[model samples]
Target: SSDVVAGYLDAKWNWSTLVGKVNSSTWKAHSVLSTTDATKNNLVGVFYNPTTTTKGNKVFLLAGSLGELNRSGVQRKRENLGLKLVVGDVREPTGSEPSGRIDWAEPTSPLNESTKTAHQGNLTEFLAAGGSGVLTEDGTLVFPLMAENGNGDVYSMMIYSTDNGSNWALSEYMTFAKCYNPRITEWEGSLLMIVDCENGQRVYESRDKGRTWTEAFGKLLGVWAKPRLVFWDVSLHLD
Candidate 1:
């Protein structure tokens, strides 16, 4: 049920490698994002925001480099507190690992119960794409997550903070099943989430700062995976 298509912008400033197979479902239901749905299930995601200080644009996100330590499953519901944020200078070039130019500040601060996600099944299976985390202009933080159960049921969930990581909360799971590698990006002052399926990559939008959502695409688009968006005001877009 894939429809929408998001591509990777090549070095020459051209969008290339346009393959379809990666899209994300926003909830527990097998359906796509709806204009009238709220609540969801499962936890799967990585979030990022450009934190600019006196130094520069510091990209703040949950690093995936420590994959060996972060395991998937029912333990995620409780152990999610172990997840930490890795901050890097946006001025540095992107690389698979944190390098000389880009330094990582792995904060010891963990997420509290008020911000932990609540979902159904054992979300131990890992399934995610881009750091679906973003900081809205209003200073709110949002992270879209995707999780799969042992039985093969896929789940999608949202973790957000209002007081700048002071506390966190999770959204209920929706039946938006069969979607994989969902990626959410900011555009036109709105957050757009794209879900991938065998049929196409579905699109959904959230206004009022990632609280409630609505279906953006009238129809499905394509099947693409591991999607990342290039925002304006940046010289080199790193993931």
Candidate 2:
């Protein structure tokens, strides 16, 4: 039997069921698990297994908007922060008894360095944004980030850390189609990038391990739709 929390409120159960029903309405959004603030206050995050393993195991990264609020009903203060990684184990349930617990890295402060700062500038001016990082079959981590300069433009680059952010290096500067969302995934044993360009989706593949990229697909679709692609079990899955 599944372990039920003591004194569970009926309203909580009802609300949970309602949210699940609404989420099931779309298949694309269904594959990816996401969390959003109830007020739709621009606080949202997502998690998924890019490479669907037989055991359905995966890792999750989160990003959200942070800032103070002024009384004008406008976002007078805001900054986007990268999602902290939560390491955990998840397994299929055999009999509804909590199958396993996913362990995640405790939330920690962003790495700060004079030359390689985390957010790039004042928290209020930066938009915390990131995507599923490139994870190699042999186990490697390559994360990409875009710094919103509070202007209409965004600065694109990758953060390479051999020792995992304790020490870091920056990639040559790249520009996106627009200052929208950016994501990274592994395909054909290479790292590929997907970004929102002029309200359209652009795909770029890096053969030399994220050093240089070549356009693979351009204007594939509109930005209103979630744009993501990954190789799962030798097949391509896109959303």
Candidate 3:
């Protein structure tokens, strides 16, 4: 069953964490996120996206939930989007526990009121891009995020933490409307993001910690060469 690390039902609409033991080739499942909490049930937890990344000996797990919250058995209409993050500490295996262990801290709502306030009320929802985030050489943790502008336009941006996950801040700049699913990485002290926009796929570069992003047209030479020739913008230099 190694091929099948884990599986769940679509009807449940709940997302959980499942870890595999490297030593034994075994798997363990944990329900770190729940949709049935009456206290917070107001926000329906589709738990749509789940992402993970590692920094030193710590592992970070992030997930996003959305939908209307139900209170008093009544489904209230509102934007109940949220992002949750959990940190885990690594420990060596012992005689009692051969597979080692990860001590996970309680999940925190990273995308809270502060996040909305920081965005200046431009975005109505935020979701984690489902995949691994990038850890820069300078030790900054960056994660790609998709957001909806209340007007139904989706934009790709980033949420990053410089102090080793102590606090995270949303990117002040975002891609043009209708761009999403940003994939980010560190290149020469700058963050590069590959995103799919309404017209086509484009690359962007951010040097100021996501504060600003500009089109990276020079990086992919081969891809841009043909387009430039079609427009006759530059002298073609054959390599």
Candidate 4:
């Protein structure tokens, strides 16, 4: 297994990250990703919470970053956040690298101009839902995401890639406003999403990659109930 960590950097006004391999007893971590890298020059270096998922020998890392724009002599950040995908190839332990290593390729922005136009500019402040992503049985890479609209209302959705990592797209469907912090996974042939709503935690399942979502009544315990003074949110996953 492998692990990743992200921390804020005061100097760069952004964040830095480290990746490591989890052995049975020890975790050998390596300093691989940094916001200061020239590859992220166009951005403001504010790479936020990162989520990861593995497929075959490839590891995909997704993070949210603010756009950088120069206004006269001052640099300003964009109102809406953008998502970036960084891919790495896992390597076995070698002579110089005893703990093995991941060679991370340059970051790519999946939400390109065409993608934004396709969405009709309805989503703003779109960011990755921190935690782990899911790989479906059909080999689709799915990651949970939270987005805000013009009214500043937040909702949960998904971003997915069908042709491996060659291309990516955002889900057409989304949870109701104010329902955020989504935890998603694939069960059987459906994608299940557990989100904390205004009333309480609710379960939603989508059969068609995220074109639509339906509330899954009685699918998970402790869901669809009224919130209490002290209660823990339920998360869904398949062993």
lDDT of 3 by residue, 1-239 (tens): 01101221122233342222222344455565555421254454456567777898887877776556556666576554578787878777789864556777777877667667768538888877876688988888888889887798888888889899998889898988887778777888889887777665678899998888888878564223122324443443211
Cα RMSD of predicted structure 3: 9.1
Q: lDDT by residue for model 4 over 1-239, one digit each (tens)?
A: 11234321122222222222222244434444454541243554456667888899788999876545535577575533477788988778788754446778877777776775577438756877777899999999999999888888888899999998898888998898998778888877899988888887778899998898888876465455346586644452221
Candidate 2, superposed: residue stretches over 4 Å from native: 1-60, 70-76, 79-83, 89-97, 115-131, 150-152, 160-170, 177-179, 217-239
Candidate number that wins on TM-score, 1 or 2? 2
Candidate of highest lDDT: 4
Off by over 4 Å in 1: 1-57, 65-82, 88-103, 107-128, 173-175, 208-211, 219-239
CA lDDT, every model vs. true structure:
0.45, 0.44, 0.70, 0.72
Q: Can you give the TM-score per candidate against the true fold?
A: 0.47, 0.51, 0.73, 0.75
lDDT of 2 by residue, 97-216 (tens): 422334334443333445444433422222334445555664555666665554556655454444433444444445562534557677668766666666445566775655677767
Highest TM-score against the true fold, candidate? 4
Q: Give a tens-digit lDDT track for model 1, residues 66-180.
A: 2112345535432122344444444444576222243444343334433333434445543334554777766767666565666777755555567755565554443267876
How much is the lDDT of residue 181 in candidate 2?
A: 56
- Candidate 3 to truth, TM: 0.73
Higher-scoring candidate on lDDT, 2 or 4: 4
How much does candidate 2 score in TM-score? 0.51
